[model samples]
Target: MAGRKKRAGNPSPGPSGGPGAPSPTLLVRGGWILSMAPGGFQGHGDILVREGRIQEIGPDLPRPPGASLLDASGAAVLPGLVQAHLHLCQTLFRGLAEEMELLPWLQTRILPLEAAHDEKSIAASARLALTELLLSGTTAVQTMETVHHTQVVLEVLEEAGVTAVTGGCLIDQGEGTPPSMILPAGRALEAQLSLAREWNGKRSGRVEAALCPRFALSCSEGLLRECAAASREKGLRLHTHAAENKEEIRKVREITGLSDIAFLDGAGILGPATSLAHCVHVSPEDRARLRDRGVHVVTCPSANLKLASGIAPAAEYLDQGINLALGADGAPCNNRLDPWRETRLLSLLQKVLAGPAALPPGKALETATLGGARALGREKEIGALEKGKRADMVVVDLEAPWLGPGGSPETRLVFAAGPAEVRHLVLGGKTVVRDGKFLLWDPAEAAARAREELKKLLSRAKLPS
Candidate 1:
């Protein structure tokens, strides 16, 4: 017994409540660990977490004194999913804005509804989105809120303990733009910078701010240039949509005498710190610019397909060495803020466009994890289950009958599993979801609040209730 590995002792009541509280030492044992790191996979391994970071990972890591024990037997442990593009403000609009293309969808439904959001409605929407995201195994996201009440959403994100980079959608000029939603260029930039100063690096870096110009068509050249300049000056990330739809692209070209990507580039918005969602209609030149400028492209397959937008060549983007990530977009467009569904669609769509060999299951998983982390510039901190990385991971129950036991863990996770199979979710070394239930928030209460807010929001917008 000289070389025997010591087993962990009994579970202890480790850390106290609250997101700012110190994390407890924890031992997660007996799971199939997918590190998503250079070490690859380990069977029935143990992971030690201390002070919100992964301390050690191996076949049998010794549990420290007074460490909490989480039994992960018959589970698959992988890095928590990251959503690179989401509209947390639109969660309450989920089934209300159906049967429309991209431009009409925004002009007719999304803009007015967004303009109607009060502080309570924004808080309810953020809570609803957060509930679905956490229960579905997403620990980090880059979300864009509507023009007003963004601080409410940021507060909700901080309280929920989800890692995020988010800010208000900047819209100043466009046809049918709600009057309340449009702010002058100078005022908009000043407001966003103020928010960044107040919230960026708050909660020990768990939450941050970004400069989000709504898009080329919705914002004037002046506002876009200002945002680009401020992004560099303040060292904040720039997020927006580009070339998502053919009609939108055409409109952008007509307005600016340049394609969406080219106009964004001319405005100085394309860079390594910027992430553009829905690059579904990029030209070859646009693709080259994206690759050359080291920009990130987030593909929202479900939203694209739902809105009848053409498929993005995600496999081709990967081949072109563009940093690619996955996202659910928004609840109104995608109808569900589920990263697993995005992971599956990210692969299956490629197979349809390219071939059977394109974008395998494992690579799709990487887009949701490592690729998303890179998009948010947090690859070194939170993407993988590696030592010294933040301990944000998901424990998925692999015993479902539909999952069967035949395929590899990655295959099962990408092709068969979903939110229903997520057994536990750990964020910053604390268990946020257990037995498929969210521990830090109440889904039922969130649902009720969303319903109330939706009704009031519809009345305010003068839409049918």
Candidate 2:
């Protein structure tokens, strides 16, 4: 209600539209278009969207008949941010676990909270995360969920109208693991495959399923192999953690007698279709192998810094020609799901690690957009605002003082702008977030449900809420 602009034409809604439905033709006019594709930006242009795909993009485009005009004056229109690694299940535990290392954090607070999650709790968590993501200009994500009630998370994602590649986290070995987190290797594979069968390409191709093993330390060799085999068989992507912390890396090396990347490669799980979160502790050999094997490295800068996990060599990885993408990780670790924060942190970290030119604004923006789509193997579809690509994009108001004179849109977007400046977000040509508000339901009500659910969950886990 706050961000929806008043126009002269009466717009008709399309498929998801209820009651007085607005038409599917969305005419986004009078904005600078940053397409994310090569030579894709236009200084002053208009976009015509129909049936969820961008029909045309150029200057002075005539509004299509029956089209709903969205005035984008004084805004930058670009592809919606894509997060390659995230944890929607942990959105409810934002401030519950603080000042803890990765392993301790997981074992003490995160695991118990995950173990205590029932269907309702998981649904609440997913809804909270999705709402935050949509409002922050993130139209797509690759979410790694906990063991049970994964269907509930998927249902929430579908209902929220966000594009995602998701899977249930697998943890079969019981040693040093919570009992509730354990599942038989074969059983876990079966469950994931079942989920893929049901959801790999659901929601008119907006949703897909992936195979996510918790990590090398927590999973057995058998489970890792099965995950690899299943991914190959089903043609699905593999998402998992790898070498985030020093202790975790040492444990994996001791168990498999190989580094984490080598072990994963030996397990047939490292390749173009795989997206490994956090390679913070990768060895020199890890870089070569990752480049040659074509694995995508997903970096979560905020979470790593918060946990005191050493900064990932993102600059080095990019130099080695490894495909890189950005993520916010989980709320407990990152404390927020805002992509703008992640982008700014990523840019700042690279500059500290290398130099002033290490990560430019344009490069950082690409990592969140095109690089993310590449990580998810969706490079041809939704990352950019091209003629044939899906209309998943965000409109950012450039009037904020932090954006200072605003010569380069990409520079301001990466360093100065934030979620508060997001005026509108479009997902698959549908106005899921309009005028800085979610159209489906009250965000206040969703936040309330999240608090109530988190209280019940902490009580169930015997922890203070």
Candidate 3:
């Protein structure tokens, strides 16, 4: 959720459009708003939107002279969800790595498929993945994009009206298989730095560029250092995968005689600006180090399960005050990008790891919003419903069958709700989704095209659907 401002109480319904809200820009009233703040979700207030920014929010007040008010009598509003770690271009290659470990998967299934990609295939795949993410209620993504597809992916986000930190790949002495056109490490670094200069802050600070090195296995010391220096010098954020598997830890030991976390810490790239995805094998000492240095951890429970990677010690990390967020790594690995689905799985997984009551609902919701915003370094813009933030939000219809038996709206939302219940959606004050349908693009045609492309891809691999 980018922008959601809150006044203490509900604002008065603005000029009524004969009991219906008007088109394009308007005010939203009569809903139980979920501010998604530290005090837990609360809102029986009104949200005032004008020209795409939350203007006012509170209990009963004179509506804007010309604003049309839409009744939200039976809905709950929350900040739009954020995907902390995302890889859309790698989508639809699901199950390609199911039979391999993380390293072999990269060397064989994952990288080879990524290597065989062209623009048409990748773009179509990205579109399909992004649409799935949107439908699943993810409004923003910190995209770990490939070298050549970064710009196009951002364009996809832009056209889709989604918010995100889009990035290009950084590889030095790259390992495993890669496309012939994959950028040379030296060239990739220069281009990535240049790209950071151009796209790090866009969409009124909604979109950003991050420095992404494939992993420590492929990125050299010098390369990692440059990435750090570039991120620091250019003020771009650092995003990477770390300590996810046994092989990765061994590779780091072979290359640097250091553990994954320590190696990154030595590189000076494991601080508040860094967002590391999949820290499953981290030690207790590593946990303390991360907390001390203020590193952000992104837990992708789905991907880990699909790859048989161990679950992250997320509950322990949370207890240690380390900022933890959620990620849908890539569609290929995780298969989908539903923030709520991820949240539910995260809680259940953590509960299994820690205990039955390990993670509660309110905390689970935070990972998708506030925590996610913090991971993207956009805490000020997205996350919670507050004034001076982007008007990004999803309206859950509480009257539906899935929620009709709800005892508590917020609790039911986190535990029971899914795609069928998102009745309305707003982004930057625009109705990108309304009544469970997209207002921005033809999702039907998008899906049809994707199906055809998926067939071609699967046929080439002789893979079964």
Candidate 4:
């Protein structure tokens, strides 16, 4: 539901495989291509992939010799869903903290568990998160991890072959913070710089670094300003939380004489390079400033409802021309990282809040796909199923009960589809998942490892079994 770009409707030379050998080619045949481009959906479409970029997209493209073929006759081929905001490090803490509000939930359960994490547990958590995301048809994500052992999460992401922009959560202040979780501004900045040096632009630019200041209450004004400056200096994006809870807003106002968005604006952080998550309580002034500054707002509907945080004015945001994307905040709060659930909830809640014409199906789909890419600053590379884009997409099987033969595919996808409908996934021209099964690693084994690591983590944290 945003800007549309013309399709590059031609073949281009692919990345070099070696000195003389040809790059791998894959032909995805006979799917309903939801290009998400200007032309919209195309029936009986064939997508040709070469050297990890989309080489051609049209009907009845002749398959070259020695190319692998994937049949998608009864599927909907579209860009892989992008989750603009997530916490992969907190995936292992699913349901460990329940029925609590934002601040107390963080102080009592999440922060302590995050502080208790060792490298092994953190690695296991990242693996689990990656597995869930891939199986659920999410190919790209922007995630935030806790203060220490952040590199461990990046290592897992790099090995897993998922597209991601991740950062270490910077926490320097705030009452009720664990001593282990607190990091002085200098030390936190040093660690973030180290991570950027090591992991930024890795995996052929599929994974990158972000500057993540935890939130207003957790970081001082000086640290936030430094984060803003560092992001500009390094050409990185800033990720953080803002205006999620009433108590948090009160605390921010008490600390600074302005609201959360106003303080960030004063600190030179409200702009195109920044993405603010869970902006459920932003005022009209805040929204106007966000729209003016071209800042992206990420909505996590399930987490907001679960934490009893207020719903965001998504329709109003769209009307004011502010960019918005959907996210599953974290496993502890969301209990799952499924983008389809987020998409459906994003539309339903908005319609409930502001009449039936609020967020339509196509717009919701756009927010989950292109809007997410725009938030991550990858709108030109990913998001749309057009020629000359990266070959990252998901195939959804429509031969299911919920998605019957009634409405358009977009309507069915937004209002009816779920994880069980995702049949195959292609990332960078590679078949990572086929027939709802991951080709890289066994998800069951990943879950088992996460359980074992959780036991160790809780034991180390002196928590109940």
Candidate 5:
């Protein structure tokens, strides 16, 4: 992806030419590089990026001819943040479905609103979410879209130039499910297969497809089994929610005579290729199943807390050798797509749940970066500033007075830094955000489009605007 041209007399460093032009080689010089790799953190280092991959990382590297130079003095350079679970389709519904648990939040407001989405609304929602994510230094995600018009979301993701693993929500049966959102098991599987054929490996393998079954309650046993089989056969990732709330867990046990995790396991859905979200209420047996099966767990601390769900045993999960990652969830639930907020919340919540030493700043930052990459099976390609990895990084201006100079870089990043401090975001060797402003498009225009689309969506859903 080529970057927008730098305007005349603008000191901000960016790609040299207009969009669609060849991606310029970039040399990032003189930054405190926190590589997130083993013994990789260094002060006053330079990174060489060419052909969308990191070529070298050391102090005082020679700048290649005609390469764009990003002066990173007094900044902290780190790998781009990765969000393991998100719902970009819900970006336009922020603050619209408050004071509700998971089931009600879905039945009353979220489902109907999602059911009302048209192509235009979906596009608007995607653009708005991508704008917030990119500005917040999130360069990769594992997101799920609503059932219909998922192609529109994939198209928007392509245009935004982010690595993603996404697919439509698969719901074959559930109470209060919108009629339009429901599909037969065969139809849903076929639809996902079709989506994979079209979108998987697109953008040089930046955008891939996953099998998302919504949750155990929303999907049938047959649908879950078929998804598991298909995922194993096709080498696709399986994503879903499990054991998130007490009420939801009770309902699942009462209906299926098993816990949510047990049900999914019986359906052949527990494996390394599967990523389960919100394992807040897992039993010992369930935890064993997850760890034994090598299933990745994504803990959305803000969403679980806001919906009155219990805090997850994140520190315990790490202790048990279960791969753990972080996410902000959807907009209506968390109200923000910022990974920094999630990282901070995860650390504090773990401290409260365990002890002050539980999940320290360095480990918490690793969960947000390396853990997320492992969850998406892209650890070799991203999550570090190593040679031959994709050039996905964020330059954070650490000169802010609020981030007192006493703490370590990891401490400041996990506790003090935020989106405002993210000076530049580079994805695939392209500088999409520079000097705290997006160079691809105007965020104001994206917000304006979301506002108009939200109005139309409310009208269609017959809900109060």
Candidate 6:
């Protein structure tokens, strides 16, 4: 918060229906609402937000007195995007390990740089990542933090008024390996839990903690079991990387003689509350076990492609009834953090793996919104534009060049629009991004700070070849 200055752009005309402020009510008039309901896309309707929850939705809704109307006439009111996996603090080293595999990338590049990065740099990266997400129409994100200083990231999230589940890196090694990045994993995890107690349920349940063990190879069975026990004790979700690349999977197999899912299941870690990121190398049996155990998979398409982590068979997972969500991973690997791009890329990747008929455009939209909400267990609160639900929605400006012929909104939304096309966005009935600008955060300063850190990080690491 220290480095961040007030954004130069004028704030969103002020929040509508604010109590102390002049406006005490708001009526969002005339918008093509993509309800995300069972049938999909309530193309012509309006949403009324009285006090941060939708009060009504229909044609020509009655505008209450003292109500300020958000003129969403030319936009599609879709649910705000949810990012199920990301290391926001890693924004400083996005392209550091462009060629190395996952384990080496972490051990040689990511871990060393992250360990060296000061607290100020970590906070700067977090702020920049959150600002980019807001501009890209993300309502919530499950962000991972460096083991030592997660509070800084949570602080940045609070300052931005974003919904997020945070995880502190859990590793059990010392020097020469990624676990060396955080020695004495137990103490590190304990600190994380202590911080969790302080910040988990803050922002009116908008933020929470997840027990994050970095990966199988980076941790010992004892450490993972301890983390699972802690998660059970706290009823917190378990967030971890699982079988992201082949080398990692091979290490787990050698150590345990079990595939990824079997290893986690045997460790007594897999559960309904588990949010596993990048199940690209998971086996068929692993997929079945994941479904049976109700494990949610958060697919990071952009990062997977950039890192060559092997595209996950997301379409097959969806067909098997496994819950799926979307994430961009982080800015460096993705070179950008935008859910709109993730949604499109995830679908197209599935198509590349399977066929054109697989992973349709509308399905991709669902993965980013509804599926993501389900993955985070925030089903009741988010994932749609409906009365009685939280006012978590994004307005896609339909005036873009791709939408000129007025094709299907699902196609246009997933394929055409990136962060640039997201003109206005709202999270929990508050204006976070309007006219393509942040309401409270200054992204330019945050980005500049991150770039400065990136240069130093790259210079230190052996570039992935």
Best by TM-score: 5
TM-score of each: 0.95, 0.95, 0.89, 0.94, 0.96, 0.91
Q: Lowest summed lDDT over 10 consecutive residues: which window, candidate 5?
A: 1-10
lDDT of candidate 4 over 276-295, digit per residue (tens): 99899988888999999999
Judged by lDDT relative to the true structure, which candidate is superior, 1 or 5?
A: 5
RMSD of each predicted structure = 4.4, 2.4, 5.1, 5.6, 3.1, 4.5
Instruction: Flag the better candidate by TM-score, 1 or 5.
Output: 5
* Model 2 residue 152 CA deviation in Å: 0.8
Residue pairs in collision within model 6: 94-332, 173-179, 175-180
lDDT of 1: 0.88
Off by over 4 Å in 5: 1-22
User: Model 3 — which ten-residue stretch has the worst lDDT?
Assistant: 1-10
> Could you tell me which residue pairs clash in candidate 4?
none
Better of 1 and 3 by TM-score: 1
lDDT comparing candidate 2 with the true structure: 0.86
Give the alpha-carbon lDDT of every model: 0.88, 0.86, 0.76, 0.86, 0.89, 0.77
* Candidate 1 Cα errors over 4 Å, as ranges: 1-22
Compared with the true structure, model 6 gives a TM-score of: 0.91
lDDT of 4 at 380: 85
Better of 1 and 6 by TM-score: 1
lDDT per residue as tens, model 2, 1-465:
223343345343445432122337888888888888988866889999998789999888998776776667778899999999999999999999999998888888898889999999899999989889998999889989999999999888877776789999999984457797899999988888898889876656778888999999878889999999988887989999998999888888777799989999999999899999999998898889999999999999999999999899898998899999999999999899999999998999999989999988888999999999999899899788998888888998776777767469888888988888887788877787665767767789889999999989988889544
Q: Which stretches of candidate 2 lie over 4 Å from their true place?
A: 1-22
Point to the candidate with the largest lDDT. Answer: 5
Against the true structure, candidate 3 reaches a TM-score of: 0.89
Candidate 2, residue 119: the lDDT equals 94
Show how many residue pairs clash in every candidate, following the order shown. Answer: 0, 7, 17, 0, 0, 3
TM-score (C-alpha) between model 1 and the true structure: 0.95
Candidate 1: the clashing residue pairs are none
